[model samples]
Target: MSFIARTSLALSAPNRIVETAGRSLAYRRFGTGPDLVLCVRLRGTMDSWDPLFLDVLARHFTVTVFDYSGLGLSTGTASYGKREMARDVDDLVSALGLTRVIIGGWSLGGFAAQTFAALHPHKVSHVLAIGTMPPGPMLKPPEPLFLETATKLSNTVADEYILFFEPDSAASRALGDASMARIAARTEPRDHPTPPEVFLRSLQASIEPSGPFPDPDDAYARFYRNTDIPVLALSGDHDIMFPVENWYALNDLWPTLFVVTLPDSGHGPQHQYPEMSAEIIASFVRHTAAR
Candidate 1:
């Protein structure tokens, strides 16, 4: 591997910007091989990702993580709606001159990833989602605990455990601690956190049903069924926000969907097991790539 690709620069990679769609998007690009553009979760900035996870992904693909408009270090209006967010990803991809790339995200960002693929299928090679819900109504609703912990102005380690990792598991809690430490170890200038007010507005927007982002004629389940693009949804055994059961319910409906549930994991499977998660993602992309 080359120096830029081999060296884990997730902690120190210079932040870059590109003018797109009347906004200046702040992003970090690292790794090698295929392009992997990962969107951030709700109330998350570019700094929210675990450094170890990015480092592991860097080994196999050129990864790009960015801040959504009006959040973190980016400029312009921000909308929590997935279609609107997908527009940001599309603009960034065009500005970067990337032809086809794997679009991925965590939590709310996952919604944007799926929408982006549905909207601009020609520009996407694969859809990689983590800790996100399936389309249509869920078999089970999100736990109340998620909203209580997620909307906090600032989260403590304990709050993180509850929100991301399996709080009751000793092993998961330890992994969560390590992941948080790795994230904190990035001493370079980082993006700012999503403000409490902005995030609160986002929370409301997410709850208010805004319909499908795919096609006007296609509903939520129909979009997944018709889309031919390969999708990999990585989740935990217990996700307080968007449970794995919801995806399982529609397992046979999504033709190219691959779902993996990590044992003793929670919302942040990537954080709990960064190396394993990255390998799973890399393998998925390599195995699903076009011939």
Candidate 2:
């Protein structure tokens, strides 16, 4: 199917429920090829993704998107820690009877993806982490201005622009506007907004110190280092929240890691540069699967 057609199908796709771990989870699957499951970012639902971006990805791989427990249409209390979040994803995978899947996680989803690969290495074939930092002491906190803008319950278009795109780039701002338009297009049976308390818990879990890793500084190192699984990490050059430097440091730790930085973009590089992002991810998945 064409990109536009696939995107429309995704937006209008009926909700599918699967019972896993004593919880009813909502999920949607699109396209065909190697299995590629996407873990949503903080405060995001299954429908929060940009249609164009998702379409671009769906064109190349079979993509699965789902909500965290207690968020969106899923049932059960949400967990804050990435390990627990990873477990939720693993359950979803098992519920769907998928194996040897490629996982693409954005922002907080990236953390969960890493944790999942670490905890269940046999199920994962490749890891693609976007606009995320490795769990370690060297990670920098989000900027005060960015944090203040993002924490607002009702963020204006300007606030969202600042939070997702580079402030000084008009082109980037235009892409952000287009992304918002696509996200807003899913009108029927739209997902419920994540509760404030749940969002706060997830954010706190994302920033808090790790509880499962033996060494916080080497949390991800133990998982990806010397592993055959191809890891592709990408970020926006102007990401104020996690910053591209964090990803750079992560690549430094694993020399074999494939890393890319999208120019003139911020936290949501996939939204800002969907075609390039999808192309890179598709290439990485195909290359890794061929091995």
Best by TM-score: 1
Model 2 quality (TM-score) = 0.91
The number of clashing residue pairs in each candidate reads 1, 0
Residue-level lDDT tens digits of model 1 in 1-291: 334233458988888999887889999999889999999898898899988899999999999999998899899987888877899999999999999999998999998898888788899889998999767766677899997998888889999999999999999999999888788776666788888998788667656553333324346557678887888989999999889997888778888889999999999999999999999999998888532
TM-score of each: 0.93, 0.91
lDDT against the true structure, per candidate, is: 0.86, 0.80
- Which of the numbered candidates is closest to the native, going by highest lDDT? 1
C-alpha lDDT of candidate 1 relative to the true structure: 0.86
Worst 10 residues of 2 by lDDT: 208-217
What residue pairs clash in candidate 1, if any at all?
A: 32-62
Query: Which residue pairs show collisions in model 2?
Result: none
lDDT of 2 by residue, 1-291 (tens): 344544475687678899988999999888878899999877889888887777778888888999989888898978746877898899999999998789878888888898898778899888988887765644555677887887777778998889888878899999998788777778676777888777877677656544323354564676576577788888998888777786677666664578889999998999888878998999877766423
